[model samples]
Target chain A: MRVVKTGIAGTLESSDVMITVSENTSTGINIELHSIVEKQFGKQIRKVIKEKMEELDISDATVSVNDKGALDCTICARLEAATYRAAGIKHVRWEEK
Target chain B: MEKLRRTMLYVPGNNAGMVKDAHIYRSDSVMFDLEDSVSLSEKDSARLLIFNALKTLDYEGIETVVRINGLDTPFGVDDIKAMVRAQPDIIRIPKADSADDIKAVEVLIEKEEKLAGLKVGTIKLMAAIEGPLGVLNAYSIATASKRMIGLAIGAEDYVTNMKTKRSPGGVEILFARSQIVTAARAAGIYALDTVYSDVNNEEGFLEEVRLIKQLGFDGKSVISPRQIAPVHKIYTPSQKDIDFALRVIEVIKEANEKGSGVISLDGKMVDKPIVDRAERVIAMAKASGIQFDEEDDK
Candidate 1:
């Protein structure tokens, strides 16, 4: 799915990550991540974001995350929320494998 | 099937820090709250957070409960749809006014359980009676469905409905509390008291706990982690009670062996009700981790 508008999800609270997805005219996915635990889990968080974007079938977008030690599941949920908001889709099929 | 619910700690559904570390506090149950604790704009986010937490985190055998939004709200349907898939131990319904309110939610839970390939009654329900109407119909609400295991009082709303606020002496809520406990007892379900709300006032908190216990409440809802220990301590069966129960059990066992229907201890006749109470005492003792020597009398 392609992004229709800017969408944001999550919060800056400890053990949470806020993600903002905006439409990008560029060729590929661009991600900017800011996290306190960047030295340890930065690469892992980036990889998860990229994987989630691919799973949603979005190849081009500007995604940014401000993470505060959130877990992988939390990150995925926020990404899905932001993607849905950006795509302007309601009624998310959450259980679709 | 009756699990210990002495202390249920409420963790805001959107607060990942508290949700992740909730099990460490060792409440008998950790309630992921998606109702009042969450703001309207963040309702969807909080639901997602709790769903993910339930799916990913290991609660270390602590019973997981979720307090969902009321069915009247737009978020309630989706809240139940997401939470049931996560398979919490109990779903607490807020502002439950009658049997219909409970049945409405139960129907949805039944549908979700079937779709998820889970046993139909695996997810239990706990109704929170927070209004005068709910208090009056407490019995029917408690027995509305087979999945309902308990009923809890939410005093904040109840007092508001009563045109008053919560006083330290709890004079305003005595009748409501008594009504709820009686209804729960009549239905053979657990009755849980509301939160004390004053985390700093230890004396007042203890007084409320004592009153609830005296009125025969099974347990209480605790807002902070500091409240868990006191509730558990008060609910634990005393040593004297436990020892008496053990003796009663031993006497009953000997009577059973000899095919004698009549039994007595210290010239006091023991009956089925007495035996049942003794068994419950022993169960409570075991659940509380109190050790006793079985061979002392042997």
Candidate 2:
């Protein structure tokens, strides 16, 4: 799996690691996610994100996530972050456009 | 009636081998499906087989639910009529578009219950909002029936109806899932994510489960027996979570004893929301078969 950075700043929160996908590609996705806050919760990060992706049919890419200090909600936010970046949605910049 | 903490394995109503062996698979819930899995001709036999399995099989500690046909279908009424007689733990009504659909089923269930001399509310209800109309009307469906314990999406159907092809990482149904979760939570009911159909793709299924849980779903539906263990493994509360939950409970108890509405813990406010979250952790722990102290409940 290639981590293609769309060079977008869709950082949902500084504390959370976010990943997004480009909206144009709709295929099938595979993701393997792990959390660092508690290693035992490794499976949790994977399970939650997988369900969200499939329910939404995000299959154009495979996402491998290694998370540190993340909660249940952050997993979604981060995945959305990656998705938004890939979708080419412009992030709010510090300077007016 | 137990909290569905692990996998809900879906067994095709027509597949007797899978149905018989399903008990040994060790799922928290076994949903014998009468939808999608069975063809139109097999509906009657499938219903009979499911009824027999419910009546005869020894599904120890496994919640047995029948995914009945939609209210609009001819088999929908028959499926409920026969399955309700068996009195499974939960009745999963598929393709429910509104509260009216659920209410009609509830009335039928009540009628069946009375006829069978069972309790009026014996069988809990769950609806699968599978279409665009259903997704938009999720709230009404959830609140329509008191018998409803959960709401789920028919991912395949929803995807087809939306006419959006799958993306590699799954970005399409995000809005619908979030909507269902919000509606379910608002209605004070359990929200279940749809099945991950590709059984061979373990990594894909795991990621989806994680996302659904993050989206605030209580559990997920699995199409194969192999999917159950992984889902259960993820849902099992971690030691750290258990410890924190216990601590939260302890602090809340201290505050409660002192006539305080809130307490301080870990340098954060422990109000109702915090306490409620802690309670959820404990509840999930309990359902996961994790050990904890009675004082863990403030």
For candidate 2, give the lDDT of residue A29: 66
A1-97 in candidate 2: lDDT tens per residue? 2334442211223234444343234445655454455468767777777775664445566665655554454455446545545554333111111
Per-candidate TM-score against the hidden true structure: 0.93, 0.71
Estimate every model's Cα lDDT from 0 to 1.
Answer: 0.90, 0.73
lDDT of 1 at A12: 89
Top candidate on lDDT is 1
Error of 1 at A62 (Å): 1.4
Residues B97-161, candidate 1: write the lDDT tens digits.
99999999999988877777778898999999999999999999999999999999999999999
DockQ of 2: 0.01
Please state the error at residue B295 of candidate 1 in Å.
4.4
* Cα TM-score of candidate 1: 0.93
Give a tens-digit lDDT track for model 2, residues B46-148.
5655665676667886888899988787778777777777778999988888889999999988887777677789899999988999999999999998899
